[model samples]
Target chain A: MTGIEPLAVAAAGLMGIGLYGFCLCRHAVRRLLSINLFGNGVFLALILIARRLPDGPDPVPHAMVLTGIVIAVSATAFGLALVRRQARTRGDDET
Target chain B: MTALDSLLALLLLLLAARCVSARSLLQAIVAFIVLGLLLALSWVRLEAPDLALAEAAIGAGLLGVLLLGTWRSLPLGHGNERIPLPWQGLRPALITTGCTVLAVLLTVALHQHPEQAAMSGLAALDQLDAAGVDQPVTAVLLNFRAYDTLLEMGVLLMALIGTLMLDSPLPRDTELPARTMLPATLAQLFLPLILLIGLYLVWAGAYSPGGAFQGGAVLAGAGVLLILTGFGEGDGRDGWVLRALLAGGALVFTLAGLLLIPVTGAFMAYPQGLVTPIMVLIEFSLALSIALSLLLLYTGTPGLRRRGER
Candidate 1:
């Protein structure tokens, strides 16, 4: 296997593991972690592709991935808010 | 074929697996942070230092704190049960087979026909020197395709707004109480140093890998630490100024870009000889907005204020 290919495979494996974790984890927090794992896996794939660009490294993909990181964190923050709200409402209901 | 690349890739894979597989949420969060660090290393290997800095700061550091804070607030032993696989025996095999086939196809395709040359990127590379920025990624992000960056700033603002809408009003005295907390002496000693580094990163972004996003995340970490240690609280709900700062980056960037339409005949087009200054302006605003947004997200409140305030 070539250098980039292995990284790609490993990233794909990470994606699979994240998917499995998401499927089996019931806790919303754990599920969030799993979803983040999935995101990192996609990021890994993008970096792998970035490595393969001929001549100078592809700046476009690098820029896109940087944007992607910001978007991912924003989304994760939003997801955390949703989780907290659900937990709070559930607790209120239980009490 | 370098040993460093192989070792880093191996470490990344192991950490990625552990992040998902760890039984303890704390362990998983730690592993996830490590995974992000290793991923940063991978980006460095790929010759993407801009991404490396971003992955380390935002991906590993700020996100790690957010995850840990959320874990702290959740009730203990709430998510301990692991669900059994639905198909019992056949599912694992099927998944493995499907994955293997997909991997093979991808590998074959990548090996057979490499990606076509990015024509615009090549053009950008040719004109990079004229853009007055030493870093290609920054030039691309702000100069070559600034519309995307502008839109991304909008997405970030929208996300923060969405989160605020979903969260309940901040508790009176929403600052965390000083209950059995870790010794924060070290944090106090290091806070100024970290803030200095964050500012340096933002300033250096024009020429190097460090930029607004990473610096903003570091700044947010500082705010998070202050909140955790009972030094401050999420009490800025009535502070319209705080909300404006949170929205300032996008608004300023958009307005500045629009203002250029008449003079430059294009949105976001800087007047000749002023591109770098314009970029710096946009970046600083972005850093403030991003930091405030992330801090507010963690606080789970509309805003924050000084401790003991109304």
Candidate 2:
């Protein structure tokens, strides 16, 4: 097998780990981390697959992964905001 | 080449597993950040320097800062658990078994499948001259598949707005203690240099493996440094300038696409010779917006006033 296959497999392993963590993790922050990990796996797969080109790696997936990284951060920020507010509310209610 | 690839693949897997399985949240987050850096390295290995820049900057740098900030904001004891999977005895076993089977099957299929497909950017690259950018990724992002970039800017803007609306972010200025973490001397020395590099990255983007996102992330790192050092004027609440900066990318891309639609005969298509300047303008605005938007996300506030300011 070529070098690319191992990277792909690692990425796939990350996806499985993310899936397990996302479902099982008790902490909201951990869940978010898992989600981001899963997203990273998908992005990595897209990128590694782009290596099949001859002239150079394909630019399309590179661009898409760039966009994906930015979008992933945005989603993470939003989710963190939601989690922060929820945690605050929960703290307040307990008091 | 194969050795390096194998090493990266192994390191990524191990770091990722540690990130997922670390006993504490802090360790997990640290591991995740390291994983991001390693992933950036893998992106480089894949021969995409543009992505490497972005992954290292936005993915590892900016995102790491944000996650750490989030960790700080959460109430104590909430994020510290090693929390097990929600599954009881049989369920965990079932999941492991299922995942292993699927993974094995997929790996086999991937090995057997032929590599022929129509997914390469070669066809689009043949038209790169018309795309108005010298870098293939930039050409693809700013011209060929520009709609995605435009909408991504929209997503960023929405994120900022949503974060602002969530709650009062950051401790009230008066409540914030002076000298949070980084020393003043360090910030004074490094901030300017960071900003210079950020600008250089943006400028180099046209013909090189740098661009708006990577440059924006570098600038956001600068902003994060300023905020941590307690000297930043990130307060965006009333500053129309800040508001404008936050919205600039989407506004520029949409307006350019709309106003030129009739002239260019297609939305976002630059005219015969105007593509260069237009793309530059769009990218400049986009970078600035991304920087500000990311900083806002990091601070989780619509505005940040100086501690002593009224």
Candidate 3:
């Protein structure tokens, strides 16, 4: 173990806030936003951990994070579509 | 540098809190977008520029557009009602306490930095020449861990398919709304430049932070700009060409990996003499598919058409 990094502390804070938001927010879209915030925290944590290596940042984790971002974005987009469908089904399509 | 990192860390926490606690969805959306950009900055500080690029493009940029569009499509006051806590009385407090405990545990767990943990990165770097890519991250993605990337493309495709099943296209606009000259002019001026940059990014990924994901997201942004500016619009009719392009990346990736097994005696291992060209082919095809899939997801449609086309 080494001295705690500030970014690690921030990552924890993000995860906490995201979890709180996800639980408290009633709107499906807001909940999605919260989940994404949580995902961001996890990504940040991984990136920070990758920095722990002596010579350079770990490319394996970097590649993983890249893949994770794409997956997150795609999943979020799909979730958004579902939200739109739900609203339309509820007769709230007044856009 | 430590001070700057501390400031960024503080900013990230504050922004995430604000994003979650804002009264209005619009405010929360804006806060989330800013948080995403700040996260990208933090990645750069952490020495992961490839992740930073992907985050900035897909995580912040494209996701922002999708969020805003969804917000616009939802009826006014539809989801803006009172946001009560998940439960009454002590449950909210209990949840908050639980989250805090979880955070603490995660932080404590993350502090351990064993010297042996560096072996994977060191091994990747040691064999970078044999991997056929200059950038270690690219090598890890397109070569060393090509299987993971291949399956990721499948996940992306499946997501697109699921979205399409919803049968709800985003509000289609055949032309730009009145009095929006600036967006139209900007799209016209920037479309070519954006296209060029996106392609350049794909080529540069062989030796840089840019790659299929980032490059594809940028190209998707270009498509979004066109759609928003009335140059192109989502069409309900499905076309073979669009379908092929949408599935091209995963198709090429699978074929490349499978076809190479006989030549290299292992799945996804490129022949020594043809590694670069094969990677370039796989990279470009993947970019094309990713870009089209994302664009379609944004459109919520099966096809896209020029504004005036039948």
Top lDDT model: 3
Angstrom error at residue B172, model 2? 8.5
Tens digits of per-residue lDDT, candidate 2, B105-196, equal: 65555455455743548876788888888899999899899999999998998988888888746443445555654475688889999999
Give lDDT tens digits, candidate 3, residues A1-95.
45778889888888888898888888998999999999998899888878867788888888888899889999999999999999888875444
Winner on DockQ (2 vs 3): 3
Q: Rank candidates by lDDT, best first.
A: 3, 2, 1
The TM-score values for the models, in the order shown, are 0.89, 0.93, 0.95
TM-score of chain B of 3: 0.95
Every model's DockQ: 0.56, 0.67, 0.75
For model 1, what is the alpha-carbon lDDT of residue B219? 88
- Candidate closest to the true structure, highest TM-score: 3
Models ranked on TM-score: 3, 2, 1
lDDT of 1 at B305: 77
| Candidate 2 Cα outliers beyond 4 Å, as residue runs | A1-4, B83-88, B109-120, B168-182, B233-236
The reply for model 3, stretches above 4 Å from the true place, is A92-95, B81-88, B172-175, B178-180
Q: Over the stretch B69-184, how does candidate 1's per-residue lDDT look in tens digits?
A: 66666667555554444355676556556655765565454444445766766777888887657777778877788788888888888888888888643233344346335535
In terms of lDDT, model 2 sits at: 0.81
